[model samples]
Target: MSKRNQKNRQKQKVNYIGGRKSFVRILEEMNEQDPNLIRFYKEVHWSRKKGCFITDTAEHNYKLMLERLDETEVNTENNNEKCNAAFKEVLGHRSGYAKELGHSVIPEPSIALHKNRDYLRIVEENERNKN
Candidate 1:
């Protein structure tokens, strides 16, 4: 609050996107010493220790990531299969949608969904959010 202290305070203007604000120290170090610190500025930072990705500390983290990735692929494939089954069932209904439900269909239907793509997309998104 003193005039001398006020004079010592510097004014700064800043803008940031996606919550990735620059640190004051890093800013000062942009033309800085320590090449390793410069390397830090260039890399994308993950709050979770990234050696966990490659190091497998307890081995659990690595396993968990692999599990999630595997589950994602499985779910995608399962959804495609379910959609195809739905398309097949719709064809069986003789509801005049057989052509729309077949291999001829550009976009296939899922096991429990209607023809409109948005509805299926919404269902999938909701499921993902819940998980």
Candidate 2:
């Protein structure tokens, strides 16, 4: 119950919170090894509550890592194309990208009506023709 541990637990918002440390171990491993750029192995335990292969925290952290990798790939100026490519390939794999709900997470649609105006227009036109 040290301050650092408490902070990480809060920051990670670990999903398998019912007396399990598996998700925390995975996060530590990722932080220590930076395995996103290389092949790595870690055993994942199922959460009885989630009924999935991984916890929500694990999935969320994986997404954060992917974003960091993308930023590194774009910002680095040392001709590190191969390094960046390796990281991207690992992220594309199921182990790195799998989610509790599914393999791919679809982004929510934009809220602005103007952005979806074309689709709305087509629907309205069809409605007019139907009458």
Q: Model 2, 1-131: lDDT tens per residue?
A: 69988888777544443245454455456647553332222134345455653656555545554555555645445424444454455445454433432223444445785468797898689999999
- Candidates' C-alpha lDDT: 0.40, 0.49
Off by over 4 Å in 1: 1-74, 93-102, 105-131
Candidate 2 minimal-lDDT segment of 10 residues: 36-45
> Model 2, 120: alpha-carbon shift in Å?
80
TM-score of each: 0.15, 0.24
Question: lDDT, candidate 2, residue 12?
Answer: 53
Cα deviation of 19, candidate 1, in Å: 46
Clashes of each: 2, 0
